[model samples]
Target: MSESVIPRPSGAQQGRRFSLGPALLFCPGSRPDRFSKAAERSDAVIVDLEDAVVPGEKEQARQNVVQALNWEEPGLDPATTLVRVNTASSGELDADLDALAGTELGHLVVPKCESVEELDALAERLPGVGIIPQIETPRGVLEAERLAHHEAVVALFWGTEDLIAGLGGVTARRPNGTPRGVIGHIRHTVLLTAAACGIPAIDTICGALADSQRLAVESEDAAAEGFIAKACVHPNQVATVRRAYTPEDADVEWAKALIAAFEQEAGLAMDEGRHAEPTVVGAFSFRDEMIDAPVVLQAQRVLSRYDATRQR
Candidate 1:
């Protein structure tokens, strides 16, 4: 959890395209009835085999997930499928993997990933599957960069609820609902580490399921802070998450204009209304903001993402 304790990430592995979806919904693996509906509603349906399932229902939940995979629902697609398995510490982890063995699962979400040894073993076991290790422990935070560079890890999701519990805290948020100090800091650590390792960083799920306005604020914060996606606990959160991930129409237009301006000329003086000290790149004025290299690159990604979503 200490900034000084962070380690450097290592290398890449057998890669698969990790979708830049906005909402990664966790449909309880025990509820097969909700599986196809959640898949259709969410950008990625993360069939959860942990937390939501009781111990007595664990095996049944595993079987349900496996059976749901074979479901011929119109919205079911392997590319949007992510299976959140039990942690290595859990006695049920092996069983979870066994349930999906030899199946072409697009992604595996391994929860409570605190040990690199467990990651290495999972990588070996699920060779071609894109792995997303959820970071929720103190050990996981310190070794995040190391985990990010793991050959199997495609993205990292910061599980704030478990993280707060692990840290012996009550909540990951303030009374007004913004992320608390330590949790917010750790969230940033996970974000930066994932970015440095060239992988997507998923923000923690918003706990206020009924508060759509608050969810929008939190999702906006996540997207503005460079998170590729937000986790969803319910179907209602999906639309807001997607909206947050996708650039607003005005933002998209601004990004397009900025990109066009950059393509036209490389000058440090194109301000009409916008003002900046000028960071020595193209200084096109855009709503009173500087148009530097980073800004330009951000615009490019925004438009690129918009195009990608439209195609999908």
Candidate 2:
């Protein structure tokens, strides 16, 4: 399978290798038959060993996952091929790590993480691979900043389903179906914590897989909320997530125009031979919006991603 690059969110560095890509498709550890097809649809493929398998099938599923990971992948970037292992505290984790030891698995989706010690242990065990800890429990949500900054963690994932289940309650939803109240609060906390720690935040899976419109709305909402990517249980969810995350053609054009205006303004300032303080006039504007540090970075990222996609 050939690789498809999903650009990281606005403000991320260009060509960063370990980006948390938009929309990862999950393949059950027991269902290797779906692995190839799932990879074809999503930005990345996650062969799941945790929630997807029961105790009786766990050992076989682990072996199947290992085989699939080691198999030839012509189109999938090694970094894009991930595995979601059993939790750190699960006794199965040691075996899972050992099973994946010699392969070129680039990332892992860690579930139900609530402690920095778990991340520390994972760091010691899996030396080089990227780890995206799934913050599901209240404890995990509260300790998100620590999890985000863990030496081994590449990104933080806010798992909505697990979170609600952990809380033993329901997350109220607005009439529009977006998460509301406590659910929204926890999501924002995870997002803000990741931002504070300078890591990407991946939004949890949208359960309404059959409803493309809802998925789009939710994906857009997640991106607006500062998540770099989202998890998808089914392959069909990939396109909607990609569309939501990809900078729109108009937005990309606007970003380019904004950057051009800034550059032109800087040139005019220098040509006018007017030396002013760094804070003079505050900044430049594209249309009515002020082009501040974040805006400028976002414009650059938009253009960068657009250009990369075009080149590919």
Candidate 3:
């Protein structure tokens, strides 16, 4: 089946704002049926063809993605589909993009992105395609600000495992306990870049699937640190990722209250009904900054997704 490109934003609003999804889809090759199940559960589907695909099976892996994209389903939205193409400088990168271009994938994630020249190559090759540049090396982290500003880049990703490996284990510990110390540093870099460019900063996957409790803790830590979403390797990890990325009910309520109070106060007011004293500037500082916007909106989005999935 021929591939199809995802829907692009209107020209008027192009490059001005990015709509970040709730989760980063991590597709590690398993079986076709396994992919189907994972796709259903994942908020975004990333058809990976890099590290996850064995060298000999790269072609077969490409074919699998092609076939899967053509398969009929209850009805899948192409907007949520992403294909993780090999890095632009890699030998297989061209073939990867050629095979999947024009398809219904929302973005092409370039692995090991370290320079603007590589991004320029990717942009030339895949015009109109969104890019998710994975910062998996020391160079990539250092070049993050430039990459974030790249014309095709819509988001930034931190690859913890590969990055630590690239750093020659300088900050890497046993690799079993927690990647937090290492990831924390890179995440801050990526987060700052994303914030400066107004793009989404995605957190790397916490590879502790066996222990759901631990996964939950790390996932929450990433979210609290300002990562918009996280990637997941296992189906069981999806719920944890979603929960971590979403705001709690209490947080949502507080946000709603802030919005209401701010609306009623018009930035400043004397709450005679609640208190005799006047509520002056900085009293509703949180609302002024729109920090609570995500909390309220994310809670609503999560509940809506639950309802939609339940109905299906």
Candidate 4:
């Protein structure tokens, strides 16, 4: 199949706002038959036009994405469906953009994103689409903060294998599956950069498809480190990722009790003529632990996540 010659949409909106759920699954773009199934099994589905498809099949894959994501009656929800396009330097992005020209798909995962200029070009070609820049190389890591601050960037994601290979390392993790020092630093760098930019950060995939235990542990660690979601290569990993991100019953109860206690304390202080903001005024003891501003915020976040999980 030849690349589609669709005309690029004009006057594309910039800096589109979008949200993603806790677990995202990547399905090869060439596999149109699995598109609906993947979307059903995951919080979001990424139709990959990059690494997953071979060179000869790229055109066919693009055609599949175009057909599957048709605007009038898309096989997948454009809001939650993401297409992973080829890197800016790969010379395939133009065809990828051409294929996606008129589709209602609103999100694209730009692999190996390393600079603001690259993002600027994408914005010019496909304005308003939420771009998730995948940081996997040394330059990408160094430029992460700048990339996160770009007006077109909606989220940041970090990859481990590519980064390790770029650095000429043998492995990104230790024997126990924990990230090595370098990989750990990069992970935190991406997380902190995204947090600073007020955007969500997605953790990389766990390639060991058969090891659900390891996937669970890694997903938990990613959630604890403040990642909004984890990317998975297989459908079976979706439940594990979602469970890891969801707040436990004990945690939900603690958050509720803490908020109630704080509200009561605030109400009493108001009656006594003391200023009570919905936040910590000073150091206070709750459940034998010192509850301060940060602790209160943590509790609030837990409740917020709990509520979101319930809604989903």
Compare the candidates by TM-score and give the number of the best one.
4
| Range of the 10 consecutive residues with the lowest summed lDDT in candidate 1 | 271-280
lDDT of each: 0.78, 0.74, 0.67, 0.84
Off by over 4 Å in 3: 1-20, 70-76, 88-90, 170-176, 180-182, 267-312
Instruction: Provide C-alpha RMSD values for all models, in order.
Output: 7.8, 6.7, 6.9, 6.8
Worst 10 residues of 4 by lDDT: 8-17
**Cand. 4 Cα-lDDT:** 0.84
* C-alpha lDDT of candidate 1 relative to the true structure: 0.78
Please write out the lDDT profile of model 3 over residues 126-240, one tens digit for every residue.
7787888899999998899888887688888878777878877765435455655766677788888887877777777767668888788878887767676788877788888
Which TM-score value belongs to model 3?
0.77
Q: Give one digit per residue, the lDDT tens place, for model 2 in 106-194.
A: 88778888888887777677767778888888889888877776767777787777777778876546677778678989888888887
TM-score of each: 0.84, 0.84, 0.77, 0.86
RMSD of 1: 7.8
Which sequence of candidate numbers ranks them by lDDT, best first? 4, 1, 2, 3
Report the C-alpha lDDT of model 1 over 1-312, residue by residue, as the tens digit. Answer: 756753323334322246647788988888888987897788888888988999999998887877667664323466788998987677998898877885678788888887778888887787667888899998889889888888778899888888889889987888887888998799889988988888888888888877888999989998888887889999989888887777778878887677656655554344321232223355666667756767776776787668756764
